[model samples]
Target: MNKRIQILSFLFLGLSQIVFSQIKEEKLILDKKREPEVKKIEKKKTSVETIKNYPPEEKSANPVTYDITNVPAVSDFKTSTIQGQDISPNFNTDYQNNYVRFGMGNFGKILGDAHISTVLESKMEVGADVHYLSTTGLKKEYDWNSNQSNATIGAFLNNYGEKGKLNLEANYGLQDYNYYGIYALQPTSDTDLKQKTNRFTINGNYDFYSNEILNDVRLQTSFLSDHFSANENQGAITVNLSKHRLFAGNDFKMNTDLGVKLETLKTDFALLNQNKSSFFNAALLPEISFYKGESYLKIGANINFLNSRNESLILPQDKKSEIIWSPNVEVLFAPQDEFRFYAGVDGGLKLNSYAELLTENPFLVSDIELRPTNTKYHLYIGLKGDIDENLKYDFSAGYSKINDMQFFQANSIFDDVYTLNRSAYNFANTYSTIYDNGNLSEVKGSLQFFPLQNLDLSAELLFQKYQLDNLDEVFNKPLLQATLGAKYSMLNEKLNFGFKGIFVSDRTTNSFEISPNNISVPTAYVSTENRNKKVGGYADLNLSAEYKINKNFSIFALGNNLLNVNYQTFNGYKVIGAQITGGVKISF
Candidate 1:
């Protein structure tokens, strides 16, 4: 009788599990070493106006959240059954599947953005992002345009026996960029300085997971292909196998990762002369982590070897192979949930991949140099926490000694006369990537505050100092940068408005063209023969408003550089002033 009862219970429970999951299941995945944090009034690290991916857009990266979520899975299983919150939450009602937007503004600009995303029955996500934007110069009538279309498909494959669950992703993208000349040298007619890029990427991971607090292992592989219109192409592939094992009580863990990276770059600037480079890399990372009440510590080391074939730039001894080693250490002290202190020391080699540079600034010269930046040492410290449950802040300072730091500077535009300060650009209307060894000291801070009901505010600031080995100044780097932002909701949360103001301190750079061979600009302090690299500070203000007509529809308008201040971020790339756009968004 006892055996029969046990068998019955097992059968009943198994059937119940299948029925409940088939009804509706949404598994929140946190295995990315991050927590699934839910909150209202989340911080906006960057202005939406910066998402256009155009010349006038901002390029700064968003601040880190500093929320430590790497922890072992909870083991306690509650006996009393309580279902999750049903019907979703009220705040999530505004979500949608498809989004469409259209806008027009000065400079003969007409822009449209559309996104279509859907989830399949097999737990696969398929999405496409398409946008079109064209702008004619308001000052010189030169036209600068861009078009971006990308598609992504991702899925998690289960049903395979215990070896692991497979996660896969595939992506394809096409983008176009144009180079309009400097304000100092406007083209008599529209020029044909443009580049088109096509990209394809595939990534996969097989994670070994179970309910126990034991060791975890995963295998990851990825491939990338980039083809440019100017006959430049790059192909890269990477594979990594990583493992994380719990050492003791949920508080200590050991981790290790081993990876292989391969890359090839081909450049055909001249039909008769083609340059090709291939690199092979092997990397190993091992770390130990300790986490307990109010304290967390981590120690790690990175070892790498790079094998370059047919490379003439390397020294004779290092021509065939190069080895690099770096140490990593991090510590955190959190006496309470609202306050924490953290510091870290690390270093590594940053592979200057072709694809990464193309995206950072597309107006690059055709014949570019590829030099990986070797970060010899990096030290950072920070304090982050919440204040009164309404304001959160982070402050960090870092210093780094680097080799082969790449800087974008104005290319010489004249061939007849050559000087270190200015020379003829090998390619027209494009910037050149210059490498220099340097030491950088930087301090950055961010804050988010909710001062009153329905009102939110945030601010960020960055300060930097550069000491170069050969150069007097670091090109295109500002000493200080800051942003102030505010957002408010009204009409019972039906209408939302946001405003952001940005400031960039004066920066000194080298390389620029003179109106003629040589010219002079008189300044308060002195008279210089040229002002090509002398750029002044500027302020930018932007405003945006959105009116939600219904749950799935909304109307929005945005004004960028509302102050109408014309400023040059690069030596000759002057940003537009006072542009407005409006569009309606619909979700399905």
Candidate 2:
């Protein structure tokens, strides 16, 4: 019995020692965690790896809808320079094999569009499209006869092979408009106010899918003419090649681009007689790019040759030839995954084609001169990043020096005999292109927010300032611009709503100088009196809604200029007032 008691006592003492040791170890661990040194280390590493590996957010599935009516609102000008192509409305619709839509609104406005595509084989496809829009005269009192219409037809083919892809497209368009800016002056009749334009274009491209050298080739041709006997033809070809090699213990991509462009213009004026001009341009661009970790750098240069010839009997005889060299450099640095910084310096030559000018202002003088714009240098810096999974932001600033920058002014300033004898567009209703050396500074910012899975909101702002060498103001260029848009999807993605708003600050332009003697007469008499005019600021609001009835059919309604402000895009051309249209969409 005594031996059993001793064994039990020994087992109890061992158990007590094990329990005490465990408690002491746990207390030590808690005390260490409370220390300032340990707390700092824990905070530094919290979620660091998780954020570095976070995946990019998925893109929105719902498509953005566009305005059905083709209103020439001043809000359309988003920047100092107008860019992008005037594509048919059919190409802007939702992705479908076959689509059709039609709508109508006030001021005798009409919209019609259709697109058809079919797959002939596993690697071949063909498609065609047609678009039309028109509107009658504005308010009756204006007596402007501001009739306008646009029609276009296009066809395309695509072929895909194992190693390359080929694409071909052709398009023809007709535009009819009236020079109704006669409100600024007195007119006896609207006899010579109508204008018609015709354009044809063809484009072809081939892209190689390979790990080797050659990349792609492209060719384009276009012809444009108007009822006033003005015609233009243009053509261009481009080739791209690239290779990857190891240089200085780093992998680098060397790229080369070769291009050539030709343009010919012919114009017939009753007073100035016939004029013909030709322009030729050639360019070679070479670039090298290298990447290390999260940093990327590109160094490049552009070498160009420009030539122009004027073969005219009545107009001034002139010729020009020159060679231009410009530098190109770009850098991108990303210290972490959430932020990126980019900087670049670039420049190029911009051909001032008749078609391009007409797209900006339809009422252009037939005898206006053509010149090429050269950008000496452009320096820019930008930052882009994400605030969180639901918000993204981009901000940028830039400065540029430009030679032969184009501006528009009243034709009455010409003060030639043609102004007195011309039958149409002779008054202050027409515009002519002028050039000057200038410097531009700009700042821009944008934000995109997706608070919910089916909701999207965006806002953008731009500010621009210009300094001209000779000109008084940046003609018809806005100083400040803003755009806001929102989209929502609901009801199992069957119903959608969209809203858009545009705002622009005051724009300055040259106007007919008022007579110092207070005598009201034709502006042609006082041609030397040049004065500045301010076009008032304006805002445009648009709303759209769509409801799907089934898989193949949907109904939509669009409202434009909801604020009912009749603002002028040009000096005297005013757009239509508030208008609404409803249409049906079909897809097959």
Candidate 3:
């Protein structure tokens, strides 16, 4: 009885499996039948009409009516209408018309490069840029617009060596600019129009390496010139030297660079307006590293110094100096092949000076009247780590403080009664002067993460605080921003599509003092009263593909802003609309 039962169980299991397979096949067939189909149809029609004629038609006679004498004549009415007309007047009127204008200008560049051979390489590039732009829609009355263009031609020659290499490059550039406009209201219009600029640049680089104490060294220099349209000329020269791995050791390395650049700017604004400026910057960097198993630590420091001077014939110019020093330390911990953690901190201090040209008389100022200085200090710390095969994360935070900030203050006197010392024949004009000694503080933080291989996301936040002696109250605010983007590959990885988005939020405040003796005077002081709020969002879809039609010919198409969403990213500026462009490329 047991054997018989086992046999029956096996038989039943086999039959059930066969039945399930057959049912699935039948369902699939039914699904295929339910799908729609396309077919052709033909139609035929037939019609019949019958007409019967009785006899030939005959024509009938006409009836007449008469009223000849009472109708008005057209000739009499034409003479009556033109009988009393006075069509002569001699008059003239003259009036002055004025207009305020505002406008915007834009320029862009599309560049391409191709490699030719092993011994020789060449690149072709084109670029256009606008110089100046003004918009008068904000003021509602005055408008201004300006623009300029530039073109570049470049070529290079490279040589390969056994242990080192050499490269020589030369570039020629041309700039064309024009300025023409009216300043203010006048009986007759006068034009302030001029055009200028030409430039030439050359560069050379040499790299040398050896298996000795010195690892590698590079030297470079360049020269530039500006030839203006009104016969104004200026020139500049720059020299740079860099050395790597001056000392070879298991834990320490040194890299240093010293550079000096000089520039001269001359202008013929008033038959002779020439100025020469010079700039010098130098830095020294050293890095030390210690490695043990999967844990490592590195420390680095950078010492920088800069100096600038300007000499002018018609304007007051002065010399300025700055110094900055930064030191950083980083540590990395890696226990596995796929996971790692790293953190670092960098801090620095900066000090700089600027010369303010002030005048007691309306138009007679030649020397530096006020010298304002500033000092700043900043600290930054961050941590970054990677996980799995496709996930990565980074976080950073920073803090900064600035002291002795400087700015120009404007004051106007309408008459001699308010002036301490005044001449009756002196014209009434505004006087402006610069003041220093303010304080500011800032804090910022950001985080970036990649959840997948094709997606990127980031968020940032910032806070700022400002204080000044002349203001009624201090200012403080916070700002937040975020961005997300993704890319996908299709059609055998030959075509790529992407999308991106950004968002930002911020707040600001301003304060004014009502009295000059407002030191700690609560009645004359005001608190923050300004509040601003805004929200904006935009989305873009892009598709790009490269199709190889043949060995020597190819085609490509790029469609940007596919949905044509008209939006504004700024207060007064609007985003560019949708555009579609395509081109074919040929190689020989």
The best candidate by lDDT is 2
Measured by TM-score, how close is model 2 to the native structure? Answer: 0.78
TM-score of each: 0.71, 0.78, 0.46
lDDT of 3 by residue, 259-308 (tens): 34343333222212343445555555555655545556777765556565
List of clashing residue pairs for candidate 2: none
Cα lDDT of candidate 1 equals 0.54
Tell me the lDDT of model 3 at 525: 20
Instruction: Look at candidate 3 and tell me the lDDT of residue 272.
Output: 26
User: lDDT ranking from best to worst?
Assistant: 2, 1, 3
C-alpha lDDT score of every prediction, in listed order: 0.54, 0.64, 0.34
Off by over 4 Å in 2: 1-95, 188-190, 245-275, 311-315, 386-389, 413-422, 513-528
Tens-digit lDDT track for model 1 on 536-573?
Answer: 88777666677879977878776666556556665555
Give RMSD to native, each candidate.
16.8, 18.9, 30.8
Query: What is candidate 3's CA lDDT for residue 8?
Result: 43
RMSD of candidate 1 to true structure, Å = 16.8
